[model samples]
Each structure stands twice: as C-alpha cells, then as structure tokens.
Target: NECASPQKYHVDCDSNAVCVDTEEGYSCRCRPGFADISEAFNRLPGRKCVEAVNECLDTRLNQCSENAICEDAKEGYICTCRQGFVDASPNITHYPGRICNKPRKPDDDHQVSHQLDSCNPKDPRCGNNAICTDRKNKGQFICECAEKAFRFDDGSCRLSAACDVSNDCDKNAVCANVFDSYKCQCRPGYIDLSPDPETRPGRYCKELVNECATNAHDCSPFAECIDATDGYACVCTDGFSDTSSTAGLLPGRKCSNSSNECLDRSTHTCDDNADCIDTPDGYNCQCISGYVDVSSSANLPPGRVCTVQTTCPKQKTDLMFLIDGSGSIGSYVFKHEVLRFIKEFVELFDIGLDRTRVGLIQYSDQIRHEFDLNQYSDKSSLLHAIESTHYLTG
Candidate 1:
C-alpha cells in the first residue's frame, strides 16, 4: 500500500497529517488536533495541514460567562467564577452552563440569624462622632449621633447653632451664628460702648458721625467738605478761590467771588504766542498777530497752543528789536550773530506800512534809534537796513 513505505513509493503527507491508503492510490488526512489548509477532509499531494488555533484566545470561540475568568486548556478553555462571586448554577459547573453571581444577603427569616452572627462589635465600619448599632436586617448596621444639638455632616457630627434673623439681637447689632454658639456684633460706623462686647447680653453702640459723606456740614455748593477728627473743614472747588478773610478750614469760609488765575504766572498755562485774559469764571487765550490758535476747544484750560501762520496774515504789526549794545556783549556777537538772526526773523513777516512795519534800536547806558517803524516800506529795504546797523559798545 501507498501508506506503507510512503517515502520510497513517492507518497508524502504533511507532518500534522496522516497518509491513508485509498482504493485508487493514497490520500492525506489532517489529524484530530489539526486542520487542512484547503478545508478538505482528505488532501492530495503538495497540500498542507496546520495545528488547531487555541479557542481561549478568542472571546467568541470561548463560551465563558460575564463574571467568569477564562483559562486555555489542551483542546478548549475552562471557566471559573471570579473572586467575591460564586456559580449560580451549581448543577452545571462547566463553561456555557455555569453562571457567576454574587452571594445573596439575608432577606428572609431563615437567613436573619446568619447576618447577626457576622457582626463584630470591635470592628464596626461607622466613622467618628457616631455610634454603630446592629439592625438585624438586610442592611446589617446603622450610624447615629449621640446629642440632639449635633447634626450629621459628611461622615461626622458637627455643632450647628440656631440663628435666623438680625432682629433676634439688639437693635444696634446683627446676629451671627458661629460654630459653637451665636453672637451679636455692632454694625459699621458704630462703636460698642459695652465693657464686654463678647459676653454682653445687649449691645450698646454710639453712632460715629460722618458729616462729609452725609452732607451735614454748613459748606457752600461750590466748596467740598473734608472730614476731621473734631469737625469738618470746607475748601473751594476748582475755578473758585476762597474769598473769606478767615482760613480755608474755618467754619464760615466763603467762595463767592471768582479769582483771577491769569495774574499768577505759575497758575496760567498760556502759550508764549498767546495772551491770557481773565474772564468771569475762567480765563481766555488770545493768539498774537501772525500766529493762529490751533486749540481744539476755546473753553478748554489755558494750555492752548498758537502756531505760526503758513501764509502770512495781512495784519497791521509794528515790530521792533531792542538790541543790547553794552560793553559786556562782544562786537563780533553783535555784528555777525545778532545781525544775521534779525535779518532771518524779519524775513518771516510781510514788511509794509499797511501790513507789518520793521524798526531797530541800540541800547547801552544811553539809547540810540537806528530806524523807525515808518522808515522801511519793503522787506528787502528792511533787511538791508538791519544788516548795516552798527554795534555801539559803550
């Protein structure tokens, strides 16, 4: 037969397959623990067979219960109940039949004694501030606080004093519930006159006067009141100065008259090219000739700026330069720098009798008139006259 002496007769099968002598020739059949690659019962020559796959590795192939642990065996898998659980169907202890379940608690009369025997007085699971008692029921034990004043919070008993409304305390004080007891404290802006504010039965508080905040001071509408320890003081607001002969902090201080801010140089913020004129309430800024006021608003404070006119404005301006020709000033500075600066400055303005007239004067111990405002009618003539002026050092 082909199965006998297979190697010599040219009959070969896979190592996991068996060589069967058929009626015609020979066939290869996979072993009980193996499978053919082609899924055929018998395979021809050049076919293969492989070892069966372990069923426990795949969940669909292993029929273990939900609460059971699976273990791979030689041919299949084994199922056992997990920890803290037991087999529900004790008659069927194998996989696909055994169902896992937790142990049942005492719910009937027959199981009540079993629960009572399990309780250990020394090892009750109740937390602090509470006492544990056996219930002799399905739920075994319960925890309760000892005193009626203490209430259960989280896992412990805490003191809770009863305080609902402010009227429960003195009229001048408000009621507050602390952890252990209730207390009465004075309100803000009031001082407790009692000797012992903590242990006193009723609060006796005196009202601390705030005349500035309450508008109780005899101050004018234009003044602001400043609260002091003994009394309040009155001070005039902005744009209004104190006109009273008395000091600013005095009781009868008056701010009825408007003060002239333009008289004081430090108080006025007028630009160099502008003039500050005092008004009824405030001051006004007036730009000089050949300069334009570029202030956004006229009513705004005195820091108004005046810019030079891009095109010279046709206005009557009699401009004069008083040069210092004293001995302290050197002749070179007078002739070169001084004369050049004057010529450049004169060029900025329109020179004419109707528009702007130019004049020059030299002064030391005595003054000398170099030229009058009516002398030059044109800019070129004015510039030449300024350049030719002599420096008299006396």
Candidate 2:
C-alpha cells in the first residue's frame, strides 16, 4: 500500500525515492545514487519525507551547454541543447551540447569566415585573362581583368589600345578598337579605292578624289581646271596669277589681270637702258627715253641697246627747234640774237640723211612751220631758205 500511495500518510517522499511500510510506520529511502539532505523520518511526531537533494542543480556536477538545458537525475545530470541550437566549437566531441551556436547558412554574410584562407592559392579558378581577389569576406572572391588589358564587347578579354573618341585613330581618321586591333573608315567627301584586308582591316582614306569633280566650282573665267587630290583647283593661266595660292588649292579662287612681272630681272631678257614690256606671248624690249641707236642702217634690232642721239651718225639724225616768241622778247631780238645763235648751231653738223639734217619752227600762241629737212638736199639751199623766212607777232 506504501508503494502504491506514498502520499496517503501525513508526510510525502520525493519522486526520486521509494516508500516502505513497516509494521510500526512508513519510511522513505532514496533511490540509487540519490541523497537526502533532510532527515524527514526524524521529524517530530510524524515523519516528514519531502527533502531531496538535486545534484543537477550544481554547476560543477551538471555538464550542460551555456545555451543548453540541465535536467536533474537520480545520481547525476544530462546536458542537452535547445531544439534549434548546436555546439559552437569546431570539434564538438569534447564539448557536445556544452555551448549553443546558431547553424551557419552559406548565403548569410555573417556566417562567412573572416580569415584569409577563403581563396585557394593552388586553384585560383578564374576565367582567362582574369585575376582572383579575396577581399573582406573569406572563402569568397571576385574576378577582374589582368594588367594592361580590358574587357571586349564579346565579353572576352584582350590586349589592345583603349579609345573613347575617333581622334584616337591613326591620322585622326574615323576608327575604333577591336579585340586586339583597330578598324578604320573614311570621313565625308573621302573614300577608299584600293583596300588591303591583309595589312589593315576596313577601308582607309588613302585614295581620295576631287570633290569638285562632282560639284560645281566657282572659278573665274580666266582660271583653268586642274585636278588635285581630294579636290580640284581653279588656277590662273600663263598671263594671269593669284596672290593667294591656297585659293587654287581650296575654293573661291578668282583669276584677275596679272601685273607686269618684268621687275624680276631673271625672267626677262631686257638689257641696260631698256624697258621690258610683258605681252600675252612673252616679253618685248624697247630703248629707254633720251636714247637712240644710229647703227644697223635705220633698222633697230629687237633688243636693248642705246646711245646718245648726238653720238648717232648724221644719217639717223632729224633735228627741230621752237624758239619762244611770246611778247617777252621783241622780234628784233628774235631775228638777230636768236637767228645768230641758230646760224652758229647749224654750221656744226652735216645736213643730210647720210650726215645730219635740221628743221626749224617759231611759236608764240600760233606756230609757224617754215620747211621740213626733206625739202632741201644741201646745207646751202637750207641756209638760203632760212634767210627768206618771215616772222610773225603774237
């Protein structure tokens, strides 16, 4: 009856103990490994069996995790973790259920190891032309292009020059970089004729034509058509020239009347005491002022040679004089003094085409033509006619 109902008495025993019913009274005894600190049987009058010492309650005796739960046992204790907790130590054999740690998820950032062992040195495992790097998080890394290289449009890595604008091309032509080279193209008004795909890709601006060939030119009438690279020129003809040379090379060149280029001595055959005259064909030479040549039998050579008229032979000479007769000097002074002066001057020359010839004229407001040298053959007739000449007043 005691084993069946130990609480039926005035006292009760702990569940860890067994109750025995003697002939005299009921007694309480602890089960195996259990100890009773309270002497419940020694209680006065009636035995009080409610004292049991729990060994699991002592931290030294209970081996439980900091996050685990400790249960009381009869003689010892058992340590175990909560429903979702686990051991924190890497090796859990020695400290199973002693410390509780949350399970690490591969996707969780906090679960990642902060040590430098994340990257495997032996196996970088990166793509071609790429480098691997392990930054803040261990066991994780990123891939990047190698040195002096970049990513291409085809998601490929290559070694080549980088570009952001067309100016980076050769000769400032229109071009862009490819995988390991560049592609070239011609600009407006320029086209490629002979393309060599073996040496260079795409067309180059090498074979250029005159744009004016297809377009109208504003060249002047005096200009001629000249074909040039990438354009046409409107150049002045032989008798004409432009002050601006670029006008011909470019556009808007207008040919104008060319000035006499005789000033350039090297370009002309004119000699000293001569004048160079530019002509449509070439150039011509003429004697200068106050110069005459009596040689060559009255037929002047087409060149520059001059001598004083006084030094010429008498045959080439034809002389004339006009004496001022305005009311300043009286007719008496005119005939005597002036006539004497003339008489003396005429005696010094041989009067003929083969020698020398002479004529005379007197003028005030009106002119008097006495006689031409051709009218007389000898000096005696000329002197006789001069004496018979008449005088007039203003």
Model 1: worst 10 consecutive residues (lDDT sum): 111-120
Question: For this target, which candidate reaches the highest lDDT against the unseen true structure?
Answer: 1
Clash total of candidate 2: 5
For model 1, the superposed segments whose C-alpha errors exceed 4 Å read 1-313
lDDT (Cα, tens digit) per residue for candidate 2, span 1-394: 5556655654466666667777766666757655553322222212233334564577776667666666563334445455434434332322334565433223424433332223354677655655777554575666545553454444444533333322333442444333333445443334454256344523455644433333355666676656565556777777666644444444326554565658688777565677888854356787677665322221345554454445444446777877776678787877766765565456545777556777888788898887776777687787676666666667
* Alpha-carbon lDDT, every model: 0.62, 0.54
lDDT of 1 by residue, 129-178 (tens): 44666555565556543332343223344323223312345676544343
Q: Give the per-residue Cα lDDT of candidate 2 at 192.
A: 51
In order of listing, the candidates' clash counts read 0, 5
- List where candidate 2 sits over 4 angstroms from the true fold: 1-129, 135-143, 146-162, 165-168, 176-182, 191-318, 323-394
Evaluate model 1: give its lDDT: 0.62
Top model number, TM-score: 2
